[model samples]
Structure formats: structure tokens, C-alpha cells
Target: MYWSLITGMALAGAVTALPRLDSRQGNGQVKYAGVNIAGFDFGCATNGNCNITAAYPPLQSLGGPDGAGQMQHFARDDGMNMLGGTLDQTNTGKYDQLVQACLATGAYCVIDIHNYARWDNQIIGQGGPSNEQFVSLWTQLASKYASQQKIVFGIMNEPHDVPDINKWADTVQAVVTAIRGVAKSQMILIPGNDWTSAQQFPTKSGPALLKVKNPDGSTDGLIFDVHKYLDSDNSGTHTECVTDNISSAFSPLADWLRANKRQAINSETGGGNTASCQKYLCQQIQFLNQNSDVYLGYIGWSAGAFDPRTYELSEVPSRNGNSWTDSSLVKACLARKAS
Candidate 1:
């Protein structure tokens, strides 16, 4: 199912190349597009009951075309019991399916760890695997996927309530450096702390993250991964969207990226099926279109084979017998203007 669309020259000059599951071959660079796959990393599986049924994904999405080439997910969280300080491999099959689905669509997939600032509710600085262990976890994961160039590593998901933001940034840099050692070219997504909220990004965690330098102190080859839901408080759980939250919250991040000559992708966003909610969703997409120079694209809150539509943000395509159809929200996302 790997596909490509030959579009005009380049949509804003050099859209990042979307690699394949096995080979990087394609017509040329395709603008990145994506959706998030939740549950595996933070749901019952992470809690220790190990809900294998929900762990696997396809978590299917609406048909038409896979507009977003990226699928971000919690590759690892505290769900599976880690051996010593390493990530648990007991539940790798579920994630393998997710990676495979992204590859099938010829889209780059972002595998994010679902743990917030803490693991098991304990702060990183207080008590957790040392920084070296954090690096080790990624090192092992990257080594396994080294041959899969299309897979992007989202080191951690929504780190929040940290004691030291600067130290956290340094940890993020260290994680990136470690992954580079094993996986040479895979893109790394650096998320800001304070829940990685777009509205709170610039002032809270974006600065320290910007200061994160490569081995040479010159940063490149990374993108900021931020999330913004349409709810009143931007909580993914809610269905209500306050009048201007999306505009005000995300605009600042777009401005900062534009000013800094950097780029980012909204890794998560969603709302219930209401005119207002859909309006905000469409507006946010348009907002990104206006800032294509500094914005890559966005990923809807989620959709998955196992993700029941009962979830407020579930965008998993409708299961039509053996086939699948698009949900209204996914429909709007696919129709977003391509700048």
C-alpha cells in the first residue's frame, strides 16, 4: 500500500522526505502528515494488567489517502515491566504492528513514550532510571529499528511537573545524542515539558529545548513535537472548545518557530463532532498552512483498530464490514489546504 503523489515542484521548498517501512525510495520528498495512536503506552497495559488485546494497532483511519505521513504513538511507557532499567520487550508485537501500518501507508511514524515527567508517578530526578538508563532504553529500541528509516523517535510524551526544566532539556539532548549513535538518520521529535502544551511552550520549556545543542552546539535534524486539543483547557478528554483558545495558544508557537527559523508538527489535537469543534480543528490546520515555512503538519488525537469510537478524540476510520471509511474529523483533516 505504499504510495506517492507527484506534486508541483516543492510545497515551500524541500518538504522533509517521507521514508518507507523498508526503503526510503519515493517519487521525492512528501510533506509529513500523521495521527497519534494512544492506549498501548499509557492505558491498562502500562498499569501492569498488560491488556494485550488493545495493545496491537491498525487502529484504522478514514480512507481516501493517508494525508499525514507520520503516526505518533507511545512506543514505551511504564506499562510493561522493564528489566533492570531497560524497556520491556515482552509487548513488542503490538508496537511492531503500528510501525508496520505506518510503513504500509508510506508515512513516517513517530513512536512516543507515553510517560509524563514521571514514571510510575515518581519524578525523574527523585527516583527513576538514571540518565544513562534513559539513553539505554532508546539505544536498544533504535538498534532494532535502525534499518527502518521512516520511523521517527519521539523520545518522551508530554513531560510535565518537573523540578528542573533546564535539566530536563539536557536530558532530552542526551537522549537524542544516544539515539543518533544507534540510528543515524531517523528524525527525532523533542517535546517541551509542562505537558508539552503548545500554549505554554514558548515561555515554559521551548527556550531550554532551543538551547539544546547538537554535539557541535549547532542544532539541526530535529523537530519540535507539540500537542493542542480543542477543549476549553486543551485537555484531550473534553469535548468543549472555548472561543479563541486554539488561535491564541498555537499562534505563539507558530510565531516563535517562524522567528527562530525552526519547524514543528502538532502531534495531537481533537474534539467532539460539533460545528464549533470542527471549526477550530479546521482553523488550526489553516493556521499551520499559513506558517508552512515553520510548521510541518499535524496529527489528529488518535484512531486505531482497537480504539473504540467511545473515546472523545478517537478518529479511527469507521469499520465498514472488511473495509474502513473516514470519520468527519479525518475528512476535514484530509481536505486541509496544502500550502
Candidate 2:
């Protein structure tokens, strides 16, 4: 389900995980850190069209609503090198603009298809779009950015409620093969069922997805994707955070990733700019940094397209003239330097 509330304003973003090999030196430092600049995916849903009009398109020419400017700020000021939100597949023109802006920042951009394993509320490969159709989407995308090393293919966004996890793996495998056909070495993030929940990853979706292989029969750049929220219900809608999710999620999953010599990314995570959030969110990031060997990096929930004065979980840094002030949660947690 589409969780974040969208209004008639600009919010564009994407979260990308960098290659782990660069920062996997047994040090407590995350390689990739950034926030989502959400906008293009605003009008989209499982059973609807992404109303391009409702979203503020952060094109290059638009100065204040400049999506590119947001990315540049994250990279220059916050030391972030990965930025993005979700992509509207039908709106390729806007997507092209978003990618160009991301490229200008010298950061990686995750091209996420925010369909949640379904098209029109029907699960892909199960009853909705056939596996071939899904493959076609990736094939086209991979071909488009075949040479851009900074581009990461997020196979799908937060797949959940599927009847068979194994079947989903098969579908992912097909897309992997198709992507490899064009973009040979780019990273492909494979997510599990149950909203790609970090707590349930190792047990539910990890095993089946681990078997997915590349065209050459090796899992070279295929990274696992997971999401976690700090609220009581893990819905991410509330401002209060009740847990750090260490034991309930990250710890066990860390063990699994290490055991298999695989790495995963917390593609989405964040909390409100409040005391409770500041405490738990910082702790959660520290854990990921400490275990950076298995945990590649993290991308906060959002920033782009959101008005800091309005959005509840707004991670967007406040700007006054030429100055940019990061939210407390971002400065203390999401954008915290790797130590």
C-alpha cells in the first residue's frame, strides 16, 4: 500500500545503496547515505495512474522547486552521494529529468518501480502482469542506462501479501537476467515479501531470493533490499518511535548476511524530527555503521517534493536564502557521518 501522504506540491526523491566493496574494510562506516526526494511517484498506486499533474515536477529549469538543487545540496552540504525517491514509469520524460539531476550530483540513483509487486493491485507473475512483461520493463530501463555506472536497478518496491515467495523469486530472477543482458555490472536490488520487512527478511524472503542467480550463474552485483520503521506499528505514519528494531530485526539479519557473504541495504528508513525519533533513529544508524560489513548503507524516507513546514516525517532540510539547515533527525541520525 502507498503509505506516505502526498499533497499538491513538489516532492521528488530516490534512495540508492552504493557498492559495499569500497567500504567493507571491517570498519564501522556506512558507504552510502542519503534521503528520498519524492515527487514523480506521487500520483501512482497499485490500481491507478500516476497523476503527473498533482506532483510538482522537479525539473532542472524550476529553481525553487528545483529537484536537482535538492540533490546538489545533499551531496555538497550533507556529504551525501546517493539521492532519489520513486519513479513513475509512464512519465518517462520527468524520470529522465530526475536522473540527469542525480547524475550531476555524482551520486548513485535507484530507479525504483514503486508498484509493490502489483500492477493495478494484481501481483506480477501471479495474476497481474506476466513475468515477461515485468522483464520487458527492466530490459527497457537497463538498456536506457546501460552505461551509467551510478544507476542501480531496484527491481520492485516493498512487495507484500504474495501467496508464494518462491514464485516472486522466480520473477525477480527473470528481471535480473534481463537487466544483465543490457547493464552487465550494475547492482540490482532484490527485495523480499512482507513489505521487504527487515525483521522478516532472513526467515521469509531471504532463502528463496538467495537462489536467484545472474545470467552467468553468479550473484555478482545482486544486493538484497530491506526497509525498517521505528514506530510502534512500524507503519511510519506516526511521529513517535517506540523501538530501535535491533534485536527484532537488524541483528539477526546481519548474522544471516555475514554467513552467506552477502550484503544488503536499508533502502528506506526514517522518523519524525522529535526527541523519541532522534534517540532511536541515531541508535539504529549506529548499529548499521558498526555492522557495515553486511549492511551497505541507508536512505532516509524523504526530502524532495515535501515541504518541511507540512510533511510530518519531512527530512527535507530547511533553506533560508543560501543557507540549508538539516532537520534534527537528519543531522543527528540519517545524515550522521560514518564513525
Candidate 3:
């Protein structure tokens, strides 16, 4: 469900009124087919500014039978998560551009901080920012977007290599508190340590992530963020998808979340454009669809400024100037909805 923007209204400290959109609405959760906006995930090596507009049209078209919907906009990994630095103007402008594009298109935008597992090659708990520094960064972000409800905050892309599992959970709780202290009502997506994969949930920090609490004394607004891939190792790196791994690995995660009465979203999952991948994607979505009470959504790996079709995660998107041509990837995302 998408929401239109509100205009022609000015009340003292009143938020612009748009129809509230909720992706997790009971068992009838809207199946959102969204893409990840890339470029900024490359960290400091690439240009800091993002051409978010160039990626929106293609994402808008991926909305299934429904109209234009949500897409996760990745921010530059500029060591802010590690160093707890002030918000840089260039990246702020890019985030604004992304929000503006989504606002214009009557779509929801997810602000994804693109730091994966480490900062500058150092893992999170081992030698990077202390719990307080990480909390401070999230606090700044929460304050910056305190008023926007359509915007969802993904705490950290994928935290890994924490010396102590409890420390990771404690750090996440602190960040959640820091955000809530700013009085921001935005939904928060919480990922487990160690790449936050479904495969890691039973054995790794995923269990610890359940201990996170909001300042409201509840876990009401938090969503579990997970990723899955069809490759043999269940990592997104390879193109060869094992035939039964989808059921083998993800089914247990579904069972666990359902048992706990918690909600989750596979915010990242993709495979190659091969015929087998098509089958894999459809089967994966079908599994999530059947378990809709616990699984809120599934988003493809990516497409953006620097992301090319060569990246299997991009679903082999072919660029025509600034625009992109569709592939079988979009069809796979649309399959379960049509069923």
C-alpha cells in the first residue's frame, strides 16, 4: 500500500497528513516488490553523491498489480557508524533526493545504512565504535527524520564478528533506545549480527537480537531484518543455487518467527537470471507468502547508480541510458502476488 503526499496545509508543529501506509497489516501483509538503491554501499571509494532519480522509475514499475510502492535507499558508508561523525552535507543531500523522489512518486522509502559487518575492515564489536558511539549515530539519524513516518530506519546493514553475543544485543538495545529517546515514531528494522541471515538465526546472534527493546518498554514497532540467497553456500556471491536450500534453511526461520509471534522481512534476497534461479525465487516467495503472519516482505538484492547487471543480485538489469530494461527478475517478484 502506497500513500500520496499532503500539501496546502500549515499548522503549528503539525506533520503533513498523508494516508498512513503499513506494510505489516495482519496476515494480509502487502507483498512489496522493492529494489535496493546502491552506489553508496561501496563506502568511501565511490562518489559520495547518489543519482537516486535514475533508479526510481524502474523500482516504481516493480510494484506488482499494486501501484508504485517502497524501495530501500542505501546511504554512503562514510565511517559515521564507526567514528560517530556528524552528518555530512553531501550524503544528507543524497538522502533528501531519495526521500524526495519517493515522496513525489507516492511511495515508501527505507533508509538503509549500508555498513555491512564491519567498518574499514574492522568488525563491529572487536575494534570499531563502542556501543555509545553507535548509539550516537542512530540518535542523530532518528533526530534527523523524527517526523517522517513513511521512512523506515534500518539500524546497521549487517553487523558481524562481535566478540560477545551479548554485547551485540546490548549495543542494539542502546541504539533502539537512542532512537526512541529522540521521539521518532518511525519503524525500525533490526538485523542480527553475523550478516543477519536466516541461516544464522538458530545458532548465532539472532537469538540475542530478540532481547532488544524499545524505550516504550516493548518490541511493538521493531521488524526483524534478514537476508537469504539461493547459492550453494546460501551467500549472495555465487550463481549456482542449491535446489533444496531455500526450504532447508529458510523454513526453520519461518517456523521460529511464527512460533514467537514476531514479524520479519527478507530485505535482501536474489539469485542469477538463470532458469533455475527463476524457480528458486518463485519458491522462496511462495514460502514467505504461506508464512505471511511472520514474514512481512521480500526485496530483491539491488539496482542503482553503480550497480550493473553483472552483479547477479541486480537481476541482470540492462541500462538504456539512465533508464533500465526489465528482466525475468521482476517477473519472479510478481509471481506469488499473481498466484
lDDT on C-alpha atoms for all candidate structures = 0.55, 0.77, 0.53
> To one decimal, what is the Cα RMSD in angstroms of model 3 from the true structure?
10.0
TM for candidate 1 is 0.77
In model 1, which range of ten residues has the least summed lDDT? 1-10
In the range 1-339, model 1's lDDT, one tens digit per residue, is: 000010000001122352222211223212454445444443332212323343333333432222222222111110100000014565565456545654554445667665564555565544654688778777888898888776677777676677788888878888888887887766677888767778888788888888876566545667887877777666667666554355577677767776666677666666765667777777776667565656666666655432444666655555444444556665665333321
Ranking by TM-score: 2, 1, 3
TM-score of each: 0.77, 0.90, 0.74
Q: How are the candidates ranked when ordered by lDDT, highest leading? A: 2, 1, 3
| Tens-place lDDT digits, model 3, residues 1-339 | 000011000000111221233333235432344555443343231112223332222223332111111221111110000000025676465445545554444334566665553455555555765677777777877787787665666776655555677877777788888888875566677878666777787568667878888776777768788877788776676765665345566788867775665677777777766677778787777777666666666666654432353565553345444343445755555322221
Candidate 2 wrong stretches, greater than 4 Å: 1-25, 46-53, 60-64, 86-90, 337-339
On TM-score, the candidate that comes out on top is 2
TM-score of 3: 0.74
Instruction: For each candidate in turn, give its C-alpha RMSD to the true structure in angstroms.
Output: 10.0, 4.0, 10.0
Name the better of 1 and 2 by TM-score: 2
Model 3 / residue 135 / CA error / Å: 1.6
